[model samples]
Target: MTFAFPRAVLEQHTAFLGKTGSGKTSTAKLAVEQILAANPAARVCVLDPIKSDWWGMTSSADGQRPGLPFYILGGPRGHVALHDSAGKAIGELVATGDLPLSIIDMADFNAGGLQKFFNDFAPALMKRMRGVVYLVIEEAHEFAPKERAGIGAENLAIHNAKKLATAGRSKGIRLMVVTQRTQALHNAVLGSCDTMIAHRLTAPADQDPVKKWLKSNVDKMTFERVSSSLASLKTGSGWLCSGEAQVADLVQFPKISTFDNSATPTDGDAELHVQTAPVDRDRLRAIIGDAVKLAEENDVPRLRAEIIRLNAELASSGASQTVAAPQEEIDAAYQEGLWTGCIPSWTCSRT
Candidate 1:
């Protein structure tokens, strides 16, 4: 089962909400793998607050090409361990200031001398790569709660996460927030996300916020239907709601058996199944028409690229944006007669 999200919105960020054992981590892992497969240049950082699901899902380094580098951010002696990146000691990550103290204290992970390490090491690591960085945070609510959070040290992880959400886009950083308590999550995180994978949510408060988030007139009945679907969803099925697309989808992941001895799930496995209404033809045509119009106008790669990007977004979510193409660009296209250029080429010419 292949599940493709709108790349445009997906580039910004994403959030996954579900109960434990609801396959949130598995879904997240599959998403990461998919992104990596698309772009091998993708760099990722996984912060497992409890150090389980995300940590163990990496390939080992062989005598040949090195495997992906995996690091554990919080734990005793709390130093970073190099799995695929050999020749690197665990002391370096511990010696760096990148580790948040708040995450340290909350997890009860004793880093010993590494306490001073992160304060001095974080800035350096922040400067390393310029490629796409996927930051995965599991049990996110503990780090960024709206109320009764721990003082300074325990809040560092949450604070850093928010900071990343606000500015990471420009820096080529993408965040994937996975949590069971969607009701307690911070809006800053959700607001920053372009795609949201909603699993089983039983909270009314949590259910209400999404309606407001999408600014959609989703009635109470639709909300309940969406929520109820999540509760009974199979391992790889859930609802995908985004600024650009909202669909009941089943994401089929790859099978894990194809890979080496790695614990990561193999490719060719279905991630989830989405059960929802059929595609609305009229709406899809309108969206396609708008995209064609944009392509005809301007004729610039950047501008046309943006239109295609938006079209994909709308296609995934089944939602349209209120922001339309600027009037000046449209007028210029018409004046230059560029508007008709793409139309004839696109028509089927069928009998």
Candidate 2:
């Protein structure tokens, strides 16, 4: 199953929407996998507020081989437990340091805590990011709601998300928002994405926005066919609506090379799949070195254990470890990769 869209979407904003169990995460991971493979120095940061198991990114498809190198933050599988107030420090680390694929698991947070964390994190990340970064926010509506009644916390969260959507591009933050509740996602945020990979969405309000976009951007037949088929689209299959590329495709995204941790588990599945692709601890340190230091400055006790753990890893890593290319070279390659990420699946034609 191969899916194609504008290759340049790597540098822009994207929205993945559908109902639950409709393959939104699968397609999102497909793009992330492609980006990492297409660009070796690729840096990705994911905010999984739902606390989903993103650690699978480091594992191979069969869970037998070492997968991509990833930094796990504040979860059951985390290198260090997350401190609630360390959001700014964490944000600054990702902004300044060179990172592999990293997931900030904020499942421990309540709504207020979640907003407070992003309140500092999102702005700092948007401000200090150096090289190109792809920011994936899963369950985006939880961050930027159309109308969530709360104190200033919810409002700030929504505003920050909108800022990421509107102003993040200049600072090299390519945002990919994943959500099942398109009806609840803010209009500004949803409308900002030029590429929309839609999965099964049966709700009328959810379909309304796609319909409106299709009405003006696509031809009448395309609008009708796509809008009518949303209710019946099969799992792991849907439409790719990119008005700019002029492609409204019926697509089944390619299978991910990594484990599908997002897949819902069946009954009696007691064996936890914490297994990830083999990890390089020294490489992981290169990404989290500054973060550990920041923890020390703030006197976060949990990270002391991490510092000791990493020291052992560094000593054991030995001479087999390799040095990465210089930052300037990596940046150049990233810019070049932006134009070629989806080239393998791409085609040019006039409708």
Candidate 3:
């Protein structure tokens, strides 16, 4: 069955869980494609441990027109210095709407380096952008583990991830975490997700968390039925559960128009060669410069004042000022000049 995700849910937290070869990555990419396709102004940043998977989006294998202009950071030969000012500048550029869809491939770095990179970049990006940006973390279990005992820099990375998980929504930084091991993932990160898309999962470790999360809306009998049916789920099929939708259902994802660069390589397959392109730094700077000019022309100070007033009203009512209000109210506010031009429409109202 077709499952339609609301715009509110798209701008919130989402998780995709499944075993290897169960289509977790594909499903996550499908969600990203859907979001960007539905909203041209929307942007996404993918953190891929393997650099090759998302290259298809940058350029087609068959030499056709590319899907999106992706600026990639780090690769097989070397990594971007994430802790340095140059690295922070990249984050700032993205935060300021310079890069539309950026990919940070961690294949070049070891565990320690990857941890440092996340610790440095996550907060920087959060500080720069308010919202309308989607950060997709592939293999999330490695970055935010349930037990961060002795990984050195990884501990700090986990802390940074947890902080972002809890507070990033208010700033419009939405996370889409994809992982094969559900139990190994950090509890804080999983608990923060508003939506869960689960594929075939047979192991009790993985099934337990999904079962527990689903228990809120699904009865024991119905849950058992659904659990039993999960074994029969094929690739690209799963259940979509979220508070935004009234009922969860077994759903099959539609085929993506772009190439699946993340496809698993088969034995005896010929070696594939592809060239990596550098990011257009000049163009990115110009984009950010134009954005700043637009904000100035739109009277950002007045917009900020209106946002502060709205936030105070929400807080006095004992509701989260960061959470969106109802869509109707936001629409009315926009008409009445109560809405701010800076905030995203999705976060304008609680859905």
TM-score for model 3? Answer: 0.72
As for TM-score, the candidate ahead, 1 or 2, is 2
Q: TM-scores of the models, in the given order?
A: 0.54, 0.78, 0.72
lDDT of 3: 0.69
lDDT tens per residue, model 2, 1-351: 355446776668888989998988888888888888788788899888875657767777766666777777766566555644567777877787555467888776544767878888998887788888889999999889998968448988999999999988888888899999998999889888877888999999999987876777688998899998999989988888876676888897777778766663523252254456555666665556665444334332332344445545655887322232234433443532322221221221211
For model 3, residues 1-351, the per-residue Cα lDDT tens digits are 554566666867999998887887877777877787788688888877654466555544442545556765545322121211133555666677766688777665544656766777787888888556888888898889997657648778888889879988888789999989899999889889888888988788888888888787566776787778776779889888776655466778775555566563523232234333445656644544543333233333444566678888888999876845445545544644445443642364233
Model 1 Cα lDDT, one tens digit per residue, 81-177: 2111110122222223222111121143223222222222233334442555666767777656656444434455455556667776776667788
**Worst 10-residue stretch by lDDT in candidate 1?**
82-91
Of the candidates shown, which would achieve the greatest lDDT relative to the real structure? 2
Model 3 RMSD, rounded to 1 decimal: 19.6
* Segments in model 3 whose C-alpha atoms lie over 4 Å from true places: 1-4, 60-63, 76-87, 264-351
Query: Higher lDDT: candidate 2 or 3?
Result: 2
Q: Which parts of model 2 are misplaced by more than 4 Å?
A: 264-274, 278-351
